[model samples]
Target: MTSGDTTSGEGLLESLEHMGAAERAEHDAEVSAAVAPGREIAVGQGETLLAVDALTVRFGGLTALDDVTFDVRRGEILGLIGPNGAGKTTCFNIMTGVYRPTSGDIRLEGRSLARMKRYRIIQAGVARTFQNIRLFGAMTALENVVVGTDARHRTSIPGALLRLPRHRREEREAVEKAMALLEFVGIAHRAADPATALPYGDQRRLEIARALATEPKLLCLDEPAAGFSAAEKDALSELILKIRDDGYTVALVEHDMRVVLGVTDRIVVLDFGRKIADGLPDEVRRDPAVVAAYLGGTVEDAEDQEP
Candidate 1:
């Protein structure tokens, strides 16, 4: 079926989607039976979900990321923070296959992603939202989320063309899943609204909902709290934690120190294309190098500021 015609079986799809979520939680529980199930692990404390080792990316004469190495453990929020030109975005580009690294390796669940195509990278269970919001502005919020779910549909082209029952069912399932995801992210009330018409905070939530629709194992959010008011940032923080609680890992590159410190389990600091610190939020906040590179003053000064 055409993308527009995929919402016919919402009831069946909603039920199926709930079943899937329950099943996923069960699977995760079984895997964690030896440990505590459903408890979010601390960064660096579990099996690696995404790893980069000695990764170097260069653009002609400038080295964007030099010898960057770190790992994102499954079921934790890993915050990547840096000053401008610290090569944070470049590192993301390399991991997401937007730019091939000049040297070194990027591994997702132990498989090297060197030189993989962008589409292949998505299929490999990595999805990202841009620093600047990217959305299908002309489409409704539901439609935008559907674009993300489109990749996971099992219907064949010929069957869709002929309007076969199975294809219709799959198409309907995709739309319902998209709606459910939007609801989960607190944007379902705006589902019928055009993306461009929503407020800025809603737009950010929509972007996240879309990315999650891809069913990615690792979700990378670039500057998700940018431009938000303090109250809005607080809500966004809750949304992020809820996502993590739902059983997906997050890798965030954010500028808001409050949001980063409030949401992340561990923080990775980058400066001049090199990793300067990686530790718990409190430890990273106190790290001299991290403070120098970005905080740019004494932790005492930071502590003295009004919250």
Candidate 2:
């Protein structure tokens, strides 16, 4: 039941790669359903999956967030964008339970997450990747992803220690699902590699795959396209779209306008920890305050630059 086993990687991949076309299709469908279970709402529906209601955070005399309110719709990619020190990551930390809000509430499907433990929030079907890569340096990519699957596993520590049948079954299933997620993120070929040995872009992809391994209903990505080249950003855009297409709600906190505009259905602009705009991508891109706060320019100047 532990991640110490390395034989699960290539063996499972070889088995998957050897499947017939029809079998592979079935397996892929199963992976899709497992990764995002019970998420079948239309992308444009006004249903709210997560609500950040008048959320404010402060440290001493400084207010990092000020009554910022927004919602991530049921099946859309909502981009949260802002310049540095504008409280983008601060919001993420609050949503993920790394920090409790000084005031206001964060609700997932109308349930208050204020008092929930970090693990409980994760079990409630919200998972996130860090702004900085946080993969286990010594673990294989598959092993790292398998750790995420632990959140959904029902086996007890006693069962795991006793080598119980249910524990072994869960381990086998976790390995299969982890490999499928790696494949989904286009990194199955590197499943056996140590996470530290991967390239920067691949490491980002690995972190995403690990997050997906949690079977989350809403996936929050913080600066996923950071430090990527143009081509890598383009590829990341496609991957994010593919993820959304497979029926998961996404909250993307990104800096790259092109990546955010290309993949998100809507955008929320934050400035000085206050929400300045919340609308379609085009509208947010054209907002005077967004232009000034983010790009330090006018709307015309922002339009002249490539999105």
lDDT of 1 at 201: 95
What pairs collide in candidate 2? 258-307
Best by lDDT: 2
- Worst lDDT window (10 residues) for model 1? 29-38
In candidate 2, which residue ranges exceed 4 Å CA deviation?
3-29, 36-39
Candidate 1: stretches off by over 4 Å: 1-45, 303-307
Q: On residues 1-307, what C-alpha lDDT tens digit does candidate 2 reach at each position?
A: 3644445455645655666787567666776678656456664456998999999999999999999999998889999999999899999889989999999999999998876899999999899999889999987888888899999999888888787999876776677788878888998889988899999999999999888888887899999998999999999999999888888889999988889989999999888899999999888888898998996789999888766
Give TM per candidate.
Answer: 0.86, 0.91
**Which lDDT value does model 2 have at 58?**
99
TM-score of 2: 0.91
